[model samples]
Target: MSGGPAVVTRFAPSPTGRLHLGHALSAVRAHDLARGGGGRFLLRIEDIDGTRSRPEHVETILRDLGWLGLAWDELSFQSERLDLYTAAQGQLADLLYPCFCTRAEIAASLSAPHGPAPVYPGTCRHLSPADRRARMGQPHSWRIDMARAVERAGPLTWHDAYAGEVIADPLAQGDVILARKDAPASYHLAVTVDDAAQGVSDVVRGVDLFDATHVHRLLQALLGLPTPRYHHHPLIVGADGQRLAKRHGAPALAAMREGGADGHALSDALRRNMLPAGFRLGEA
Candidate 1:
């Protein structure tokens, strides 16, 4: 069968600023895949970090996409759904732990020869209520009890459109944050829960998310949700053959919008990398 979307796909972008080229590529590609498969294209604003997200940035993002003639049927924001994120955290709380180590401490531990950066030293994890309460006034966040979550998740598997097959072990990834002590929740918790609630069946994102997908897959398993097919699409790189920065993306997409890129031109720009046969960007 020709390459086509098998289920509902999404492009969840953080509304921190204007959509960049990398963001546009991911969004457009996911949109195309969904459309091609006769599916729906959903947009979710990852506005969990309220400090960075602004109303102006959100407006600009929508305007930019509208300029390109891309439309979505559904939209959501992570900031609005704190209750759902908490429920997901609760599921992990029984098995989850709290992490209070700062960045410098983590850096010092990782600097030691303990394999590829000791995935979370597992410090400050699984603290007693007394221990947890002790830091109530101090700045503290919570982490999932990965050990128990993994056991709860059981064996899991998923197929990737580009990477073929993917399997993960949560223990290796270590315990990631579920809720920041100060913030309502962490991104891992928000995205996992949101995807489940939206009933997203396929995750079409950039290749850089390959590692994060493992963690996401673990969350899906832990939550007892059906795992979605993953497609780690190639990222659009710049002249240096690397993923373009947020600033760089702002200009690229802006220029595209300014050049009267109705529909065809935007499509052409996105398809540039995927069109040519035997054309690999950085592999050479």
Candidate 2:
């Protein structure tokens, strides 16, 4: 099957919020990439964040996709695949460590300018056995030891359709959380596991996650998963030159559809790279 059909693509969206125009563009891009070439288009619900994800939003997602004339060949839910994430976490035991630092504590301990997210200072990374034993049963999160993980994985690179071959620098993000007390897996871990498990050959998403691809590439190497070709597309922003978000009051697809906008017309416009009034495309 060396040349069997085109590579499979997916549109994995979180059910935490309503699908907006930006989301539609991403879904349409992924869907067209697969369907236009006679390949399969898969849909995966990234509902790992149970606190925010809502059933209503999931239903809206389905309806929105249908309205957009998009159909996926297969569907998957992350909530139902806990065992897979757990198994992947176990495999990285050698490169994982417990992070007992609270958000406030981390903020107070940062002496260097680590930008928006204060890179974890590794305060509890080398805690003595006695200290760890005394703090047993305390709420904590699991983080990958970036230094060790990078060393173990050696030099790694991933091919991006837009950027070409890119070298991975996982340490740039520091020790990203892999597991929390409430959630078994983080975005980095779950996404890496799911893409591999679902046999995703192409990753099409917004460029805002371009930097994250570096960490994912490293994780794929460490987890022995095949690296998928990436295509980080530009994001759709409002006329204010800001990326659309809930706070920005970007109109949701459901709202537009309810407002009498034709679904097929909208889809056709997006396919032609046209944005709605007061919205424009920008690279992330």
Candidate 3:
């Protein structure tokens, strides 16, 4: 059981909307994993996207988690940890470069597809000093120099609870943004940095983020941070056979609580992996 000590885990939810069934499953799973082994569970509010994140949604998140009987040892918000992210960025500055391309410009520059979405063409990676100087006033974000970063990190692997040991392939994502023009840190950077800072030993999240792990593994290697065991659980899906999302109009945990639903009963069912009728775990 490797039960030497309790492994720390976290559930980071962005407060862009109300807590949904999907969020409930994630929080409960993480809390159980921590408490099951005499470890501590932590909560993190990933509200880096100021434009979309709302204070009301955050209040609802705490209320929903409490109703579900999921409690955390400590609570941290990304908004309060700006300096930590900035310090991490400074450490990786050598491996990052300024990206000046706008959304429209990036889209226009892409002809061949790299992945599901358009991969950045690295339009500004090789910019001349004069050209860079000319655009100093333009807002720019920082991107990881994937080539150098992977070279430095070498071949890497991370363990998964179900998938076993897997090799990392961060190149597929190309040069991902480390810092955003609107936010101090991108999700990839912030989550990686925060996990390391918070001493999270295990990462419990949805399989939809399985691919993103490749990039996170690279970041951990580059930043000299310890790699945590990951369990990419299946996502909760709606009756329409689609992953639960706001767009899908999935029922919110708050709505369920208000409608006379029992939080303790829901938590028990979730602990037993018995989702309500009509709802099931989505395929990887």
- Pick by lDDT: which candidate is best? 3
Error of 2 at 50 (Å): 1.6
Candidate 1: regions farther than 4 A off: 1-6, 113-118, 126-129, 247-252, 259-263, 272-284
- Give residue 18's error in model 1 in angstroms: 1.9
Q: Write the per-residue lDDT of candidate 3 for residues 175-222, one digit (tens) a residue.
A: 999999999999999999999999999999999899899999999987
Candidate 2 residue pairs that clash = none
Better of 1 and 3 by lDDT: 3
Model 2, span 1-284: residue lDDT tens: 24565779999989988888888989998998887667889999999897888989989999999999999999889999999999999999888878888999998998777766677888888888789778868998999989999999999999988889998988888889999777879999999999999889899998888888989999999989999999899889887788877656778999988888888899999989898889889964
Query: Candidate 2: misplaced stretches above 4 Å?
Result: 1-5
Q: What shift in Å separates residue 18 of candidate 3 from its native position after superposition?
A: 0.8
Q: Count clashes in each candidate, considering only residues at least 3 apart in sequence or on different chains.
A: 4, 0, 0
Can you rank all candidates by lDDT, best first? 3, 2, 1
If scored against the real structure, what TM-score would every candidate get? 0.86, 0.95, 0.95
Off by over 4 Å in 3: 1-3, 112-116
For model 1, give the 10-residue run with minimal summed lDDT.
275-284
